[model samples]
Target: MAATLNEIYNARSIALIGASQDPNKAGYQVLKLLLDEGYEGKVYPVHPKEPEILGRKCYPSILDIPDAVDVMVVAVSAKVVINVMKQAEQRGDVKGAVVLSAGFAETGVPELVEAEAELVRIAKRAGIRVFGPNCIGMAYPALKLNTGFAPGIKLIEGSAAYVSQSGAFGGALLMFAGDQPCPQGFAKFGHIGNMCDVSNLELIEAFNNDPSVSVTGAYMEAVKDGRELMRIAAASEKPNLILKVGRSSLGAAAAMSHTGSLAGSDKVYDGAFKQCGIVRMDTVEDMTDGMKAVASLPKPKGNRVCVLTEAGGMGIVSMDTIDKTDLVLASIAGDTLAKLEETLPSMAMICKPDGYIDMTAAVSPEQQAESLRLVLADPGVDAVLLMGLPPIFRDAKDTAERISPVAKEFDKPVAVCFMRGESMAEGRRHFEENGIMTFDTPERAVKALETLYRAAFRNGHPLEDLPPAPRHHLVEKAVAQGRNLLEPEAVSLLADNGIPTVDHAFATSSEEAQDAAERFGGPVVLKVVSPDVIHKSDAGGVKVNIRSRSEMADAYDAMMSEVASRVPGADIHGAMIVPLAEPGTEIIIGMVRDPQFGPTIMFGLGGIFVEVFKDVSFRVAPFNEEVALDMIKETKAFELLGGVRGETARDVGSLVDLLVKVSRMAATQPEISEIDLNPVRIYERGLAVLDARIILSCGN
Candidate 1:
């Protein structure tokens, strides 16, 4: 099958459904822009009454046209959109439809929503792919096609593509981009209006294969299909940038464990981005700045960065910002430091902390170029960030002309922060036109360098796009009989998934409890087995350290009475008696079905304070052993697990194996909705699941 977007964007002939001669209407603007921009494809204007529009023959309807149309541009009102589509579907030759009409599902009206659904059914029946029912449409600058009504702007040709969920904001940004003195050009621009049909995922999928697109960026308020997006982004050959909103609406799932309360949706999205190797931008400014930087510069060879500045204050600010990012200051080599000392004036400071140099405001443009050349040549430096605040005596444009050529000579990435605002416009423009990433602030420039390093690292070491595994066997019976699972059952679930649980047995009566304890031949713990008691300790349902059979029986009787008094009318089930587990570093491993992203696994410090000190990390599931290790390293508990203050290293290998198994179970089993394995003690050579709680999907 043909690429749906390719058919629409590169159509041989187009039928403009609501083309008009009136200047005020969007119909007129869309047609005029297409014709004026010199779209190579044939245009057939379709209007109700006009015989001719914009010097082209106008048709009453698509059916009346004699020739076949490759694409249909629908610019009609929502009231008659169904009728227009019905008529076009009869033609059967239209391959794609750009439905630029409004008044569909976005209005929250029942009638329009029904009409939108009907429109989708009609298009699919005729084998026609739909773009949008409430969008401004798309623009392909490289192909000279204007299927959108964004007016008065002509986008220059470049290798970047942008997709937006908000139509008005998207078009305005594109328009502003096209109007700049040295605008960042784009290959394609699309707006997903209501996402009735095609979305950012489809567009990104199409762009991933297209050779003309080098980088892709989007302005998304939300995503409907995060799984597909994650898959596409991880496998992408080029860099992907996203400005995802909804940060202020951060909230966690209202489920039954620390996993649900700590794994906020926004933080999960952050983890997903990192997992898929995507560059996340925070604002429109970031989107534009990031796109330009990635499209223009070669990625850094490594994370080590060197900062060169002509002013002391700018150098200080640049070094401070670099410390906050993954990019580290390079340790300038001895040869390079000696060269800098001999070449610079006495006012210059050389490598105070590391890979930073401050040549005072009095340095000439020639000296600036020489310093950049020497720093970039150092084997320790992977990239260079140059900053300058031109004084009244120094010429900004002259400095740009001198440094731009030298910056380009090295294959390493270069990000320049040229301050003093409009006074340095000439210098900034010089750098931009010469293909150097330039920013107005030191922080922004460092961020660009960081993007380069991250992209390069991911490309060299790509992650596996693991698919969902077969359903785990334990999930079958758990869903059928669901609730806060009993201790024996929950522990069985973990053991079945290749995890080790302490030796345990279930007993209904006091004599049975004593017999079960004696079989262990050591101290044991007794925990009540009742679905009603969600937190056993809080409900007085737990008693530990029973050395004798008499002590076990007495403990069991007293616990039952205490639980009955605390939780009135609670169903009193029997007790699970298990041998006492050896103490070690306690950690939590959890799985919760995220409403949007699905099956996010978490790891953190555990044992009672799991909720209080929420030092946790999350990863969307279906990952491999390497990624599982990444999840563990992301938390502060990693240091403790490795041993702190001369303590022996716990069994990190055993914990990693457990995490991988839990991840597999989470990915394949849809019925096991949430799981909490709190205080899974990690011993020197092995680990044990001390307690487990799994909440099933249904069983109300």
Candidate 2:
């Protein structure tokens, strides 16, 4: 177990090693900030030469402190970092150490790697938690702690706790409150560089557990332990916003499997984050913007939003932005509309169904407030996006004051989008200061509202703790063969798991293939069984619609000869003789082993569309039917499954069942690294797996 964050963030007595009087040095800067930021704790500056620094008595070493040190902030040479830990171990009172030097593992030197490793080993033996050998350390405004070396970081006290892998970015976020238009502030901040000892997961767990932290934001390049992080995030109901970097095809080229090739590890991260109820942000600005909304407002009960704008054009823009998100314009109730009709000016054109109630510029601020309250009272309105507040009737601050109390009264999210102007700056601040989230644009307001709604949706529809999947003996037997499974074997694996598959049998000779075709009594398909051939058609190893026994016999011989000619020295394992599947919507379902996040399931349109359109959705494995249904619904091709062009809807419930079972199989069988069932025929009655490919792990 790692050291708890309480020891690192709430340390009572911090010792700054190599403390200096020179203002240019990092030691002087850190010590000065600690004092300047009003850290309400004892500070002991340790330096061998200096008797006193930063107007505080200096000690030569950790042993000379004459008191237990809760934290040791080291800003000395990397070569001496180990000695500092040794001193910390000798004193045995230092519970945590934050090293602010860069010449460790990041330098790619063997000696630095060994030195960093030694630092962790010593700290582990001493039961001392370590932050970094190359980091800016941490800061907590609520506790009045500023251990980082950055200057002029306005450490305002609020509820969002930020954790970052990049030390500079972490320090930058501490200054975001002063730079950005957001009103949210940090409760705690940490920069776990190198992560040689303590990890981002531990800090997130601590911050989520903190009563003062209402939102947790993380900037992570990679996760240390994917499973543990997933478990922790899944268990926590708090809103977590993460901005993950390194999402690119260049990084994805390292994958050796088809599933990995199709969707990179980034997609795996996406699925796992969603499974654990963590909101993923695309950029740093989005993460900070989202955190501000999450910290300030209540979680929305639903996605239905009521748009209230002073200008007609702004109301339309708000509706357009909301339409692009998961949020929907709420249907105004008749009674609410009648109430608005009676209360508003005669010119007020309120159309709840169309999504916005335009109060026009002629209305007073009081009228706008009253109109908003009336709309919020409707049961259909889960939240409201108010925009176009101007200083024509009343000052921006006065308007903000009148509308701010309405959010608390309704107990739902109320986001205001004041048109950007110098005059509206005070209005925005007043709205934010009074506990209402404010945005500069309508689209931003909708984005914030969407975040709040997603949080609420996840909280309401938490993932079910599914029972473990039963074993599939056929899969185990195939794995014992020490190679990827043949198509027939893959089909058998699915069959054993209660997944419906086309009638199929492996025939070693043309006579057997003929007999199998006769038994089918209709159109049959002959596919060469070669684990090496991912695409049989490309190698001339597949013959479909063989209606007669003689045709089956002839096609079998031709396929073998063509495959032998096309792919020389291939390990041909006979051929699969199966009945031809009926025409229906084709779908693909597969699971890929991500280096992180374990097995991630993917569903999308099958056949050429799978590659051409790339319409797909993903989710982590071991999910119940509800999640499976959602995974299917998220795809752009879902409308086809729902019966487009006046066609009958396919058995979506059955498909969901298949998805759930596949998830179970992937979760239960560790040796099975990948499962691809492409071109699955989805009909009005049921579904059939036309082709299957299961890749086994080398471990078996």
Off by over 4 Å in 1: 1-3, 20-24, 51-57, 64-68, 151-153, 172-181, 247-253, 459-484
What is the number of backbone collisions in each predicted candidate, taken in the order shown? 0, 0
C-alpha lDDT of residue 543 in model 2 = 96
lDDT comparing candidate 1 with the true structure: 0.82
Cα-based TM-score, every candidate: 0.93, 0.94
- lDDT string for model 1 (1-700, tens) is 3237777777888899999888988788889998988988899999989999989999998888899898888898988789888987898788888888999898889988898999988887888878888887788887788788765557678888888887777786677565443677888888878787788788877877788888888888888867777888888888888888886322433445678878877778877787787788877767776777777788777999988888777777777878887889999999999999988888888898788888777778998899999998999999998998878677788889999999989998888888737788888888888888688788888887887777667621233445655644455555555545567888887787778888899999999999998999999999988877778899999999999999998999999999998888887779999889877999999888777678888899999878888888877887777777877898888999889999999998998888888877777767677888988999999998888888777732
Residue pairs with colliding backbones in model 1 are: none
Give the clashing pairs for model 2: none
lDDT of 2 by residue, 26-100 (tens): 899999988987889899999998989968999998789998789999999998888989988898778888989
Local accuracy by lDDT, each model: 0.82, 0.82
